[model samples]
Each structure stands twice: as structure tokens, then as C-alpha cells.
Target: MSLVNLEAVHKRFGEFEVLSNINLSVSEGEIVAIIGRSGSGKSTLLRCINGLEPVQQGRITVDGTEVTAANADLNNLRQRVGMVFQSYNLFPHLSVERNVTLALKVVRKTPYAEARDIAHEVITKVGLADKFGAYPDELSGGQQQRVAIARSLAMGPKVMLFDEITSALDPELVGEVLRVLEALAADGMTMLLVTHEMKFAKTVGNRTVFMHEGRIHEEGDSRETLEHPRTPELTGFLDAVLH
Candidate 1:
């Protein structure tokens, strides 16, 4: 069975359909990227996976737990899934280490000392060991985003969802966040990133999914789908972006 699965998922807000018959699966240790133009439901799909938004129809299963079901333990499910947003979302008043440790201490019930240790380890992994004591306002945009990534990693999630994490960063700063993600990918972390960075989507992901309007228009191996897009929508998108 796939590590992550979404079968015929549908989400609607009032009369507007945000997602339609979306079906996708991600295997363990796979790095998959979802790409599309604006309003393609890319971020909404991630939100559904994390339970931030409820699906009106279909099933979404992560590991073995059903996400779209009402009776499911959402807290337990979220502990196994981590999400990083386009904005850093770090607390300006909290130090980097404190921001990373808050969830561990509050939700996981880990002791202060243990949470601090875990925070230290993840901060170092994200290459911000020295800035652990610094507040979010004191760090560069890229560094702050890395700290946010570390904060999510500290929770020990099985799958990570990145929702256009680089879209808000300066061009030069985007590389730093992408570098951290690349390392995680190299370590075989199961990840799904919603992004418009076509080059990285083509080169780094194990598979690439093209979402158009409110559904997946096409999907396949990264190289094949990006190089030889099968549909007019995908081909036009690639041409508009690459050329």
C-alpha cells in the first residue's frame, strides 16, 4: 500500500469547487512535487492532507489512518504529518530554539530537557545551530524559514508537506530553503511540495504531478512529464515558464 493516498477527494467552498476527483499516492521515501498555475488547488491539497481543511468527499489516508473521516483522531494524525507554509510563521517573540521546542513540550508532552535536545538536533540539521538563541526578527528571511523547517522536523513526522515555501522569499534566499529540502530529499524523507519552481520540480522530484483548474491533469516520472508534457495545458505551461 502507498504511504500516502488520496482517492477521489473533493473539496468545495460554497458554490466554488476547489478540488475535483483528486487521486494521488506517494510511496515511502518518495519525493513528489505538485506544480500548476495559480489557483490550481495545489496548496488546498496539502491543507487537506494536514487536516487544516476538511474534504467534502472521498478518502485521504496517510500511513493507515483516514484523514477525511470525522471520527479519526486528528491530533494523532497531525503528529505524523508536518506542514511548512510559504510564510515562515515563526513567533517573533520566541527564540529559534523555543519556537522549535514549543510543540514538543506542549503537544507531545516531552520534558523540557528532552525537547531542548531534540530542538538542538533539528536546528543543527537545518544548518542553524549557531542561531538557536536568536529571535525570528533577528535572522535573515532564509534563515528564519530554515528555522521553521527545523521546527516541523522536531516533531518527528513521517511525511512533510511544503506549500510553496519559496514563493515568498527573495530569489537568492530561495536557494537556501531549497538546499535544506534537497538534503532532506537525499536522506529519503517522504515529502510532497507544492511549487511553481519548474526546474527543481523537474530535476529533484521522483515524480511530478501537474494540476490544472481543480484536478490533476497529468503525472508521471519527473523527467518525462516535464520534458514531454502530454497535454496542451501542461505543454503551454512549460513553454510559458521555461521559454
Candidate 2:
């Protein structure tokens, strides 16, 4: 079975449908990149997969558990599915180490020393080992975002969801965050990223999904899908983004 699965998913906000008949599957260690224009439901779909947003119809399963089920263990699901957003969302008052250790101590009830060790390990993984003592304000936008990613990694999630994670970074700093993601991909992390970085999506992603108007308009091998888009919508999108 796929590590993450969505079947005929439908979601709406009040009367406006944001997702329609969406079906997708992500296998273990696969990196799938989701691409689309604003309002195309990319972020919404990511939210639904992690159970941050409830779907009105269809099912979502992660690691063999149905996320849409009434009795779903959302806490457990969240522990296994980590999500990082465009915004860093780090705690300004806390040091980077504390920020990463907070959830481990609180939600997971890990002891302080162990949590600290975990934080150090993940911080190192994100290339921020020396910044552990720094506060959010002391770091650059890219560094703060890496801290956020480290915080999620400390949870040891099975799958990571990235919703335009580099969107908020400056052009010069964007490469740093993307490098961290590339490292994670190289380590065989299962990831689904909604990204505007066409180059990364094409090269690093195993599969690329093009969403259009709340639907999966096209999907295929990442290089093929980006280099030779099968649909006009995808072709136009590639043209607009690539050129």
C-alpha cells in the first residue's frame, strides 16, 4: 500500500469548492511535488492530507490509517506527518534549541535531556548546529525557516509536507532552504512539496502533480511532466513559470 493515499477527495469552504474529486498516492520514500497557480487548492490539499483541514467527501489515509475517519487519532497522525509552511512561525522568545524541543517535551513527553539531544541532532541536520543558542530574531529568514524544519524533524515524522516553504524567502536565501530539502530527499525522506521552484520540482521530485482549478490536471515523471507537459493547462503553467 502507498504510504499516503487520497481517493476521490472533495473539500469546500462554505459554498466554494476548493478541491474536487482528487485522487493521489505517495509511496514510501517518494518525493512528489505539487505545482499550481494560486487558488488552485495546492495548500488546501496538503492541509487535508495532514488532517489540518477536514474534507467534505472521500478519504485520506497516511501510513495505513484513515485520517478522515471519525475516530481518527489526529494527534498520532500529526506526530507522523510533519508540515512546514511558507512562514517560519518560530517562537521569537525562545532560543532555537528550545523551539525545537518544545513539542518533544510537551506533546511527546520526552525528557529534557533527550529532547535537547534530539534538537541538537536535527539542528545539525539542517545546518544550524551553531545557531542552537540563537533566537528567531537573531537568524536570517532562511535560517529561521531551517529551524522550523528542524523542529518538525525532531518529531521524526514519516512524511513531511512542505507548502511553498521557500515562497517567503528572499531570492538569495531561497537556495539555502532548498538545499536542506534536497538533503532530506537524498536521505530518502517521504515528502510532498507544493513548490514554485520548477527546477527543484523537476530534478529532485520523482513525480510531479499539476493541479488546476481544484483538480489534478496532469501528473507524471517529474522531468517529463515539467519538460513536456501533456496538457495545455500544464504547458501554459510551465511556460509562465519557466520563462
Highest TM-score among the candidates is held by which one?
A: 2
Ten-residue stretch with the least lDDT total in model 2:
234-243
Highest lDDT model number:
2
What lDDT does the true structure give each of the candidates?
0.93, 0.96
Write model 1 residue lDDT over 1-243, tens digit each, in one string: 799999999999898899999999999999899999899898999999978999999999998999988898889898899889899899888999999999999999999999999999999999999998999999988998899999999999999999999999999999989999999999889999998888899778999999998999999999999999899999998888777
* TM-score (all chains, Cα) for each model: 0.98, 0.98
RMSD after CA superposition, every candidate: 0.9, 0.7
Which residue pairs in model 2 clash with each other? none
Q: For each of the candidates, give the backbone clash count.
A: 0, 0
Q: How does candidate 2 score on lDDT? A: 0.96
